[model samples]
Target: MCPEPSTSGVSPPVDAVTGIEAETDHENDAFSDYASDVSDTTSTTSSVRAYVYENGRRYHSYRPGQYLLPNDETEQDRLDMTHHVFSLTLNGDLCKTELDNPQSILDIGTGTGIWAMDIGDAYPSAEVIGTDLSPIQSEWVPPNVQFEVDDATLDWTFPENKFDFIHARTLAGAIQDWPDLVGKCYTHCKAGGQVEISEGRANFFCDDDTLDKSSKTWQWLAEFRKLSEPLGFDIAPRLPDILKAAGFEDVQLTQKHVPLGTWPKDPKLREIGRIFRVQFLEMAIEAYSLALFTRFGNWTSEEVQVLLAMVRTELKSNKIHLYTYTYLNDLKRKAESNDSNDHHSPEKRQNTLTSEAGNDDPGDEITNNLSQDSQFLAASTSGEETLPNLKNPLVSTPSKFLTDFQGRRRFLGPSSTWAYSRHVMGLIRKYLGQHQPLEIPLNTDGTAFALEFPSTKQPGTTITMQDLPSRDYAIYLINTVKFHVCQTYHLFEEQSFMQGFSKLYSEGPQPLNAENKLWYVQYFIVMAFGKALLMRGSSEVNPYGSEYISRAMELLPDVNGLYQDPITSVEICCGLSLYLQSVDHRNTAYVYVSEYLQFYRVLHELICCSLVSPFA
Candidate 1:
């Protein structure tokens, strides 16, 4: 059920700097230099056979065992941020109408495949195809989502008039000719279907009034834009006109004026913009690092690295002036296209929108054929009130309580449970949020702490914490201690903790609740200690440093035992040994080891006592 594209005449191409023969020639020279520079380096795109590259060397490059081949976490964060932006865009009325009924979708230049994956998740029934020049996406994808490593510049491989929706986003350096790409989109998009373009101007200069044009940021922006314009790809200043010219009608454009940092007048907006700045800088360092170096002929890696480091520092600082503009244009045919024969009458479409509006959830409008439950959830999370499904996704499920505790103890909580160390650690974090020094007024094993039930519970009837008895209490204590120790080890070292536990916790009906709590607590403690150690250097190590190493060793055996099912205990042991060795480098190493041994011995005794029958 694809929409028919309206047979509207294509709008004129936007040439903001048109007929300026000198400017066009200048652009040509800049592009030539940029291409030459890209080829001279011993990089992935060593041969400048193509006049342009969009994703740079990162497009096809791979490192073994890497599921996400992005340059760094910053780019990864940007990818994550796309979901946030898309959610905002998709919630709008303009997007909702088309998306609700879209049978086919095309995502052009889908990087890291995040956008496409999210769109697939949102519209499960649609045939969604994400096209990129590289095989960067994971092999495992949604049933309706598929990726093809083909250039978008080539005549699309799909049949004409196939897709109900065509989405081109962030093409920047990749899209050499915008008109041809838009024409291809127009050709492939079903009659009356929509084509949306989301693009950001690359200039780094500030749009805010706070920063002066004389700043280094101004130069950076000028140079970046100047360098890119000559490549026949600087679409930043020409986005609006480009879409209209591609035969789109009733075109709607939304410009997002995002600030670089906490410079905005509003506090919340400043925070959001600041986050964008941080993430953008992170991407710059990771993604654009080598690309920028190669693009600028005279620029060296060392120069780029130094400048990037400075830029990162500037980005983090509240003082630096910078900002960038981003835009999203949504255009649809004037009327239902010829392809959609069973078109709803305008009256029916209005009635549908009105009917959907009555449901108190936005999902009804955006998710045309989604199940009632899913629609409710999506609408609720999307923060729009238009319609409601029979079942609300936000409603809480009945808590899974554990009967294994003393004094009617329950395990499940909003974020964690009592049975897992990670959850308990999360509880500790909750405690730490309000309290300084993080010292709870409880007996070391936590058995002696007073249990406070919520008001809904029956008035206290002299319930004893000792109801678990010595054997059960001891076993619980050993498990708790082990959980804490392993989590602690993970904080100091991150690689194998989750991977190790994934094997440990995956197979059996183990104490999942308790294990999860321990993992989180371990992470918190290690992070806190690491920060303290880093702040004080070796001088601070002598005082509380030994505690870290000791905790690592104490947690190792339980972690090893946890791994006994699949992976070798030796692997965990080796990792433990390495951690211990590294921790001991500090003067507090001996003290830490001895204390950790004591903790381990205490846990051992608790477990041994639990195993022995008190009746015997």
Candidate 2:
């Protein structure tokens, strides 16, 4: 929703120069008792008007309806609700920074100026400027904070190297050229200044595998992407890279999974999710997109309204277990000074092209590695070559798996057995199509004999599964290989994997699950392994590593009735590809190449079958 124009023709509180009403002493007192003695220096000669009305909403006359959200009281209320949700998410803190005293702070796209006002109150000594396309800020504000109506995408008028801190949040669809904005920020910020960009991931996720391609929320996102693409806006998962390319250093990305409804077991997350569902999701999905879809995307208002209703209904479903990923990228402007070149210059453009080209192509590298691994496995299985060494060159020899410590052994050993046990239990429950929870009795050896079914027909009737060593070994091998990847690659800790495994295990089985239990488990393993390789700077020579990793990063659909899930196949293929990269780069390949290939081919066929028709 965009800001609305004032219904009244005349300005509310007339200032002689800027036509903006000068805030009164009473309004100032509402914000702070000890107001600053500084007088307002707003230029009376300025020609900017207060508001322009279009499509029944008020827009800033400065930019003249460029922003799509309404700045009316209703939208302001919605913004405040969103603010509450974020405040709860951050534990009532405005930000997670250690900067004790920032002399100058700037909040870009500060809707309603609530955040800016709070920051001003927190740091009374600092000068805080809130810039937005709408002049919807309240007349009563902290003396240290001032609101300005401006377009952030334009070249900033602020003096260079002035601001000590710059913050932008929830401006995902508002800005077009992010790199340009970041560059402008770099130029204007003081050396060592911090810039924080907070935005929610473009897509939603379901931990218990309820959401999928056919889900309403997923379809809504697809529609949103369709609308956003033409506006030069995208929810790219590469903010850190953009920040780095803009010459910001020490860039760090922090992520939090905010549930859509009150379904999480964790109390805090449940509360947050509840607020998000009530305060944001229910209204925001409709409010934020109505104008864009109608005006820009050629969508009929009725069509949009109907779709929004469906989306809202889906958002309210606790059974869905939906969540959105929110990410914060914190960066520091490089301290060293250098000659500033025009970003539009040919020389700068050429330099950018060269730099981009120098970066490894993840897709090409992964494909090459996969091909090589296939050949190597074929040769080894045919007994045409000796086993290849499979040790990471980056780390010291005698891998963590080779160590004989009890703690390590337990974590890398029986813990995998426990994971296997949990995976098998989930599969059994899934196979039986059980929606209600079931207790699986395990033997002392961490093996499950029969599955128990609590009868709904008879109060105490139960069904059980007998001993199945073959099934147990199959699950065990899959889990063992995953654990080996974690240990060998140093990608993820055994404890963390187990924690996730246990959490999923506790969820048991549900109907129409979006993630296959086994596939999802292996997905994380492959993701962690791929991530480890990327962290080791493997993308430069083996870009395919990044490609597989990227695919793994995305949410995977459930296997449903298939023998194997898509992600499991992807993981096995990725594992072999990684092994191939290791061999090509470090001349080390594990002896289990043939076994990995066989498993990968089988999984690949399963994926193909699932894709064709999982129920088949």
Q: What's the true lDDT of residue 100 in model 1?
A: 42
The CA root-mean-square deviation of candidate 1, after full C-alpha superposition on the true structure, stands at: 21.6
User: Top TM-score: which candidate number?
Assistant: 2
Q: What number of clashing residue pairs does each candidate have, in the order they appear?
A: 34, 27
Q: Provide the overall lDDT of each model, using Cα atoms, as 2-decimal numbers.
A: 0.43, 0.52
| Cα lDDT over the full model 1 | 0.43
Write model 1 residue lDDT over 205-266, tens digit each, in one string.
33223243454444444445455556544475555555444445666655544545544554
Residue range 1-616, candidate 2, lDDT tens digits: 1111122221211101111111233321321211110012233123444555544555455555566766664466457556656666655457645454676999998877878876765555568998877656655455568888778888678888899999988787777667677777888888888888888654444433445556666677667766766664444355655666666677765565566665565656665665566545435666677788888888887888788777766655454555665566677877776757475333564465447433333122111111101011111111112112432122222211122333122112112221344555766678899876567543232121121112232222221122111221222323434544655443333453454444443453223233444344344445444333222222223332334333332322223322344334444444544543342321212323454566557766655654732332
Backbone clashes in candidate 1 total 34
**Residue 597 accuracy (lDDT) in model 2:** 61
TM-score of each: 0.48, 0.49
Choose the strongest candidate by lDDT: 2
* Candidate 1 error regions (>4 Å): 1-77, 82-98, 205-215, 334-616
- State how far residue 543 of model 1 sits from its true place (Å): 39
